[model samples]
Target: MRVKVNALILISVFALSSCKTQVLPENTVQTDIKQVVNSADVVLVDVRIPEQYAEATAKDAVNIPLAELSNNIDSLKGKKVVVFCNKGIQADQAVEILKKKGVDVYDGTTWKNVKAIQEEK
Candidate 1:
């Protein structure tokens, strides 16, 4: 019974941790990502799979799906990077990983929002 209780506790801990979203610290996120996008020094990344990116992605945005993100960290380390996935889930995951690696990154979350912001500029 004790073993079962310990296992249940472990599982619960894992579940809760996985559900937590990795967001930019309030100070780190800009009110509008366009400020970054419009800058010459920034990188706009689409974190969705290549197939999805091919369907449609913001102009000037590069594809770097989440699975392959870690391998490309060196190229992004010091750059201001704005990232987004379809609805933000994968983008959030990518942001968490990037932050851990000390990359200057922002989670733009939804592609729709990214596009809208760009169009307005």
Candidate 2:
């Protein structure tokens, strides 16, 4: 019985370990969104649904949902990008994707923070 329980625990551990995961950087560089917004060279990408983007987003931010990011990678290449979502979850994922493709991207995390940065003097 003890051996069976141990085997079950080991199997559960293995199952959990095999799941795909994305880890955020422990020391991510602070994203100066205000600076990005003011710069003509930078592109602000809001990686939320179109409806969410239409409801609220930073000025000049483009709507490209996380699922559609890969399709638009070519257009985003060779440019400074700042990514933000409703919260930070999808934004972090988008940052990871962009970084893998050699895009200079800043993970802006929450939209509220990005908005505040834009509003700051």
Candidate 3:
């Protein structure tokens, strides 16, 4: 009887833990990129390599590769910055770095997404 009850409790704990979903931190909440992109107070940053950015990037986006992002912090100061890359993976990483440094930043995902938001204006 004791073994059976212990097994049931273990199963219940596993079930509850498996059902949990990961939640993003408060600062990582989704922002209204469409509206924010159009504002003059916002700066759009392309975290892709220069070659990738030169090929195609959102209008008015400044190319700052992920490796060089930290070096350009001063340039991004005093503005709402939106960072994007080819697939957004780097952008997510960039957002975390900027957040630590007290920069007002958002994960704009892909440069294509930022361009789409601009075009909708």
Best by lDDT: 3
Predicted structure 2, TM vs. truth: 0.71
Runs of candidate 3 exceeding 4 Å displacement: 1-30
lDDT string, candidate 3, 9-101, tens digits = 999999998997889877568767787888888899999999999999999999999999999998887789999998999999999999889
Please list the C-alpha lDDT of all candidates, in the order they appear.
0.87, 0.87, 0.91
Lowest summed lDDT across 10 adjacent residues in model 1 is found at 24-33
Each model's backbone clash number: 0, 0, 0
Better of 1 and 2 by TM-score: 1
Give the per-residue Cα lDDT of candidate 3 at 21. Answer: 81
What's the candidate order when arranged by decreasing TM-score? Answer: 3, 1, 2
Q: How displaced is residue 51 in candidate 2, in Å?
A: 1.0
Q: Model 2: C-alpha RMSD to truth? A: 6.6
lDDT by residue (tens digit), candidate 1, 1-121: 9999999999999999889778867646555666776677889999999999999998789999899999999999889899999999998999899988988888788788888878986
Q: Give the TM-score of candidate 1.
A: 0.73
The TM-score values for the models, in the order shown, are 0.73, 0.71, 0.76
How far does residue 54 in candidate 1 sit from its true spot (Å)? 0.2
